[model samples]
Target: MANALLLALALLAQDSQTGGQAAAQGPNAPPTDEYGYVAWCYGALGGYANLYDRVMPEVTRIEKAFPGPDGVAASLKTYPELRAQAQKDLKTFASAITAAEKASPRPISEYGGAQVKRGAAIWQGADSVSKARLAQMWMSWSPPGDCEKRAKTLETKSTILGKALNFNSASATTQAPPPETPAPQPEAPAPQPAAEAAPPAPAPEPVATPKAEPAKTAPVKAAKAETKPAAKKLPPIGGNEVIVDPVNPIPCAGSLVPAKRGGRDVLICKGD
Candidate 1:
């Protein structure tokens, strides 16, 4: 009887252990306890949507006021830094949402409360900065135009913000906004008359021939012949014939004889 009682006690302990294990593994189990994170995500998303909606309408109103569509759009594109910040904020909000969804729902209520607080802080900061920028834009207006149109844009933005913050009854108080000034119309330029075709350049004048001068002839004179004296004949002498010196002989093979003494003569020398 004591052994039987011990066996029954062991079976009861086994059943309790199995039941506890099944309860722990149930489908309704919570995944995580990150309530603060979930609230931050929802608030951030709401804030971003509010900002986007507000900014876009203001931008559109400004464009309409400016009249020149391209100029207004281009001017907005110049604020790349502002646009980048907005995008970053939006992405952060989206990521937070994703993280919260993957987490346990039990923590979401607490997270939402924390997110609301954070959202309110960010909204206040952003609103102040936006107002300052708007003030600068207003200050830039010249004498003929004060920022009445820009003021209307601000009023609209405020309305959007109020709605985003869960106050749907809020409305813009700015009066009936004045219509945009029409741009000055440029005067049409006067058309110039077609120039009368210039008279064809006068036909070139006929070239005149120059008169030729008569040729001049010089007088002719006949030249007279010059008188010459008769030359004396030289007498021939047999031994007086010139003989060339051997050391200074002529290049010919025959020996030279003087045709006349004390006068020029031909000389001949023998070849080796």
Candidate 2:
């Protein structure tokens, strides 16, 4: 602890010397007192650290995990490359976290609503996971693969962690929502000339109403005619007026003669 304080004091002394020649700001920009900001940061970090330790100690376990001859390294790839990528991801995630912290508690507006919804969804998904699960991912699992995804997700939800770690008690200034961009409208179809609109097709010729055959004098007269038997002639008993038989059954319109052919019953038409 004494050594840590000594190191912090040395760093502060160096920062104080460097800040004496700090860069100038724009005419409208508010003047920043770097020493005041640094002092506040120091106090906030110290207070958060004490609170975090009390709630969950074992913080030094993370410090012991350095990739070297004496420390654990990834088995999936060359340790040097893995360690390098891990460092880059760590920095990238840290930047995303800082952005999140700066953008929290945004003002609600119709402008850029979709983006607001998207950010809200990402934060919601981040909030749904238990701290215990996150702790296991960070401290229990083997390194690489899913570790990158978990780290990126955690970075996206840094505001939640900041609050959980007791660093975000006072409300940050509400951020202005982004401006909305309108979707492009489709162009109207080119108008056709009056002649090109096309005239309605002519109505089909009225179907011919077939002349109704005067109510068919006979129901199926042609069929009956087709089935009628041919006339048979009896030996001419009496000219074309062949004698008529009262008992002979004939299928056609024929005269049946009792005078027979040589002596039997037969039928004959008027001409026969």
Candidate 3:
């Protein structure tokens, strides 16, 4: 099936089939350590871009060594050997990627090593299927198997690359600036103290009501001055005389009356 033509299809485009594709061409393969580094590049980062620059010319030269198949039956005769070399070429590519990463320290490219490794793992699984088919091809005559393993490798590779692209876009948001901070407000004024109050006055004693002292007549009081005891009022020098018992003195100051004096009646000025 499709696997029968894989080696031919997998070969890089070349000017002409000048050499066999199954071996190192004009130039030597990288040393094992450098070649093994591709496994790490496959694991930790994506394959190296410079790998094509280093190996494509050699790959092209190697493919030219194996001329045209002209037909599938004719091509199948050498494809198994070529397929084995294809596996080695994959390893060589992995090593080159790792070597490039070490020499140049390309962190960004190496970042996809995880994906490269995963794709390599799938490619390894496909190679296992290819190995089984290679054994069957030599054991007995049978049609070539379908490239199911390679199909799976392509599907997984697509998934990994899609995730890588999405990750790059999402990482861009982190580069933008953060939001601005707000300013503080001023405080309010403090309160003042209040004034003190005054104390009350003492109560006074109550006044008593005097008994009704009748209003005294000023003229009547003057008329009674003749009897007021300032100085004894003298009897008037002339007055009508009346005989009055001595015991009964004249009722008025001017009244003359007879009074028994020394056991005899005597006419006397009563209260003169």
**lDDT winner:** 1
Worst 10 residues of 1 by lDDT: 139-148
TM-score against truth, every candidate: 0.22, 0.17, 0.20
Report the lDDT tens digits of candidate 2 across residue range 87-156: 5654553454344444455432232233223212211222344444332222321221322354356455
Candidate 3: list runs displaced more than 4 Å: 1-73, 106-112, 121-272
* Candidate 3: tens digits of C-alpha lDDT, residues 1-272: 33422332232112013222421221211112322323432331122222223433433444455445564345444545544544555554444444444433235343435445533331232233443333332222111111123323433554565566567767875566667676666666676665665566666667787889999877644444345324333333345444344444444546565455446674465445
Task: Give lDDT: candidate 1, residue 251.
Answer: 38
Per-residue lDDT tens digits of candidate 1, residues 1-272? 33332232233233235532322232221122233333333343355445544556565566556646468767666444445654555454445444443333234445456555553332333443454343333222111111122223433543455355433323344355689999999999999999999999999999998878777777666666664444322333355433453334433445554332355553423233
> Evaluated with TM-score, which candidate comes out highest?
1
Name model 2 segments beyond 4 Å from true: 1-77, 106-141, 150-272
Error of 1 at 207 (Å): 99
lDDT of candidate 2 at residue 150, scale 0 to 100: 40
TM-score of 2: 0.17
Model 2 lDDT on a 0 to 1 scale: 0.37
lDDT winner between candidates 1 and 2: 1
